[model samples]
Target: MGGKTVASLRNRADLLKFDYTHLYGKGHRRPVIAAVTDERLRELVLQSRSWNHLAQGLGYAASNTKDTGWRPRVEARINALGLSTEHFQGRGFNGLAPLAHEPVFTADPTPERLRVAATGKAIAWFSERGYTVSLPVEPAVYDLIVDSPNGLDRIQVKSSAAADRGVHCSRTLYDTTRPGSASTGRYTRRPYEPGEIDYFFIVMADGGMYLLPYEVIGRSMKITVGARYEQFRV
Candidate 1:
């Protein structure tokens, strides 16, 4: 495929995957959910309370067939076809509901999952306001590149679910794993430099979002998203 086509396909896949998790909740069932295309089959899968129940309804032999086997095959088929599962719910094939003001996050999610949830919310937030959002093909300083009316803006997403007095957003990147980085094995804190990112999109513990320009909060190692920052809240 051409470069633009590949990127377009990737962007669509990412959006669909995010929508699915946002609607159905994240779990291993994604492939199976995406693979089953028939409305009747989808209804059966969603309405049925359990996987075993779904298997039985599909006419798999309860004695001979392992319920676990079916899901992988369905996922494999979808992968082979290069198609995402269509969301069958009333919302649409994407299964997206109106974006909630605050996205729901799981209890005590790991740092990586938290980052992903925040980024997903950021993408939806910008997209809802009529901007085109794209993810970088390789790792970069910014999390998302948004094509807005003004121009393309690079967005760095930060999230904090832990709060004492306020949500704490770290402005520096840490690389503790690098060998000989420091005596404490911690890399020096490096704040984002000028022109590195156009904006900082923060997701707070309460699900409050803030989109602030880089110039407004420059070179701070840590920013507390509290009352003082209320004006930037989105």
Candidate 2:
């Protein structure tokens, strides 16, 4: 005689298959299906409620990947979160998932490239003006320190994908937006302040750079860089 059917076995055990593509894209490992531990299961249970939010938390696209190889695991989570799994394949959700999705963030696709190019240009600009540059071993409040004939100046290097506007200078806003939950994080403009940074060094998407003093800017978020601010361009 044969053993119990698949549905019966699943009902008797915590045997759900998760693709784990959300963690690592595909082909890195074989047999994505595996039994999750109770602890891991608990953490997953506490994750964002809405499917869109869950996808955001997973760092994956929600509109797609619904009928993926291991959607059963997602179904398990959806069920646990009290969401109906019907029509999960479609954009139209017959059920709304939980609500703990992380803040959706937009990042430059090639920030490292911009950083390297901009840093090189900044070094050249400073060297031409008779300044010695020192890079930090461990990144801190500032990425570099400059020793000029005038004096020492501490600099914070910021890179942005935006070429049309200045880069974002942000600070986390607390005790304002969401009242109860701290999971919701909000980023706002935090202008350069005296004693915090002597200069704001910015690198734009097109490899353009600016080395502006703190006095030039006010106590507002965004440090404008372009033709007007290009006087300080490196």
Candidate 3:
């Protein structure tokens, strides 16, 4: 969002730009919100074009600051994630779906059900710290592989949902069908660099979980619920 672009709903101060969406703690330049992560806002709410331009094209607002009730807490988090801001009218991907004028369908909990609730809260947070974790029916890079009592490593289960105080996740996605691109699939939030894994059992949005490690994560991190990393609480 360095280009600083946000144009569309221009009125009540652009509906006060989603009450400064939330999430801050590392380099505070201001950009309401882009992705704190509920699977990168469900892959940018299915490539938003409506939903009033998905929080300013996933960069929230670019200044001129405004925050008032944040549209009933982001429509109570899009009706508690059941979603429906009522926009579309159809025209073959005109803003990309969501306007059939019906509930459509939902039971919530997707993205592999919050990635199996962040791999069952990081395997009950390392079996309550006593350690002895193992779950790899098919993990190749890293998901969970601890045999620690002080040994084996590799653990990466990050999760995110809360956005007002911080917690929106996204490793990648925004292919846009590639081939000459521009169709817009947008959603490139990042983090996790060093060798890709050594420990990072996040999972926030209130159910709280930490356990970070891997050089205190520095790929432009912003996570901040109980800052100080709460001694890597589980």
Q: Per model, how many backbone clashes are there?
A: 1, 5, 6
**lDDT (Cα, tens digit) per residue for candidate 2, span 1-234:** 123564364455545663333342334212322344444544554654444444444444455436354556656655676754342344554235545787677665575577567667677777788788888798555666899756878877767776456666643345456446555554334555667677877778775777777777645566556677879886
In candidate 1, position 28 carries an lDDT of 35
Candidate 3: misplaced stretches above 4 Å? Answer: 1-100, 109-138, 144-154, 158-197, 214-229
Per-residue accuracy of model 1 over 1-234 as CA lDDT, tens digit each: 476885686589797774322122213344535545665464565554344455554544455335466667654654565544443333212322356587666468554466569999999998899899999999898999999877999999988766553434345455777777465566556778898899999987566899999887776767777888889999
Q: TM-score for all predictions?
A: 0.48, 0.41, 0.21
lDDT of 3 at 212: 77
Model 3 poorest ten-residue lDDT run:
1-10
Error of 3 at 211 (Å): 3.3
| Top-down TM-score ranking | 1, 2, 3
TM-score of 1: 0.48
Ranked candidates (lDDT, high to low)? 1, 3, 2
Clashes of 3: 6
Tens-place lDDT digits, model 3, residues 1-234: 332233342344457755434444225423334334566666666666554456444454524113423445555655677855455333333343456686657576554466567888788867887878887798454678889766889887777665644543336655654555365445455665767677777876567778777677656466664657788876
C-alpha displacement of 12 in model 3, angstroms? 56
Q: Cα lDDT of all candidates, in order?
A: 0.67, 0.59, 0.60
